[model samples]
Target chain A: MNTKQTNEMQIEFDSKSENEGFARVAVAAFLTQLNPTVEEVADVKTAVSEAVTNSIIHGYEKKRGKIFIRCIMQEDEIVVSISDKGKGIADIKKAMEPLFTTKPELERSGMGFAFMEAFMDQVDVISEVGIGTTVTMKKKIENSSTFRVSGDELNG
Target chain B: TGEVKRFLRDDGMIKVSRSLKEIANKVRITKDSLNGTLNREPTLEEIAQELNMEREDIVMALEAVGEVESLQKTIYQ
Candidate 1:
């Protein structure tokens, strides 16, 4: 099992709801090299959507800021880290609890973390109050043989 | 007083909310059945076709209900 990093990409954009779709699509497109199945792609897209939405709505709290995404494609897995420099979460344990939201007035679902955790193999969050939050997610592509073929072709 | 009046006057909003909730429930059922049949997680488009609804509408309804459901939980719990 080759776990070496094969490719990497980074993107930065405004923390806005409009870019939520863009962010997820961009990451999904980047993951295409691994030839992930449709379900794999959709799972990553949903997780990305939840993470980016949290960065915009909860991290930035609608204020103008920057959201950064870094994705690294390994031989059979992809790791994505989304970060935001905004008002960070006070208690991450409480924040990750299902159905707990600090912005009820905004009608937040509070299921963002849950969705991310459900869709990805692993999800890690790092945050500091009044500083920022970073969410790192990883998912394994069960059948990415095409990437191996392409790699061999390139080497040969 | 103003909040009460606004709530009363927003009948259309309430209706839309109720309809979205109904659609969300249908979407859940459709997704579950599709998962069993397809042997994998179905896409939003597949779920939409199963329910005979537009993909965009299903997405909107699901998201709308997510917010409302969370709010309701917060209120009751």
Candidate 2:
């Protein structure tokens, strides 16, 4: 349970949908130091994708702004924080509810927070009405010694 | 005659589907070639230009497929 921070990185990019893949891949690459399983990597990537997409589509409303991503790698876990300085969520409770989306017209399935919570060990959200929103997520990487015998266990 | 008119009427949707498939194929090929040339993952803009599509379109197409597949897996599991 040694939780000493080992490494960290910060990146700032425009809040554009095109950078969604970049943000996900960049965090996944930063996570290579932990030697995570393929499933672990995919999980982090999915969570990152969801969070970043939320920032771009919801936070900025497709307007130009800055999206910031910070990652801190501890001995056995990684914490990622994504923030955007745009219109923030008024009611986080409603926003986090599964299948609740303000932009149903955009075909948003409203599962972003749900997916983040599912894929990550923890998810935290802080927001202000007109200031911004920040989402922090953490996931613990299982050591190779105790790695599941079969990936099917996740689905089972 | 009815079938022909219906096909023509739905041409917009059919064209979008065909182009999406085409864009997805070209994205794969472009990614492979770009990975060799750049020795890393190419950005969406790179793939967009190579395929002669908008960056937004590329993002939409890629995410649409990925989200649907993952959503299905999550639901079934």
TM per candidate = 0.63, 0.64
Instruction: Extract clashing residue pairs from model 2.
Output: none
Query: What is the overall TM-score of model 1 with all chains considered together?
Result: 0.63
Model 1, C-alpha of A20: deviation from truth (Å): 0.9
User: Per-residue error at A62 for model 2, in Å?
Assistant: 0.7
How big is the positional error of residue A36 in model 2, measured in Å on the Cα after superposition? Answer: 0.7
lDDT of 1 at A19: 90
- Give candidates' CA RMSD values in order: 13.3, 15.0
Tens-digit per-residue lDDT, A60-92, candidate 2: 999999999999987778899999998999999
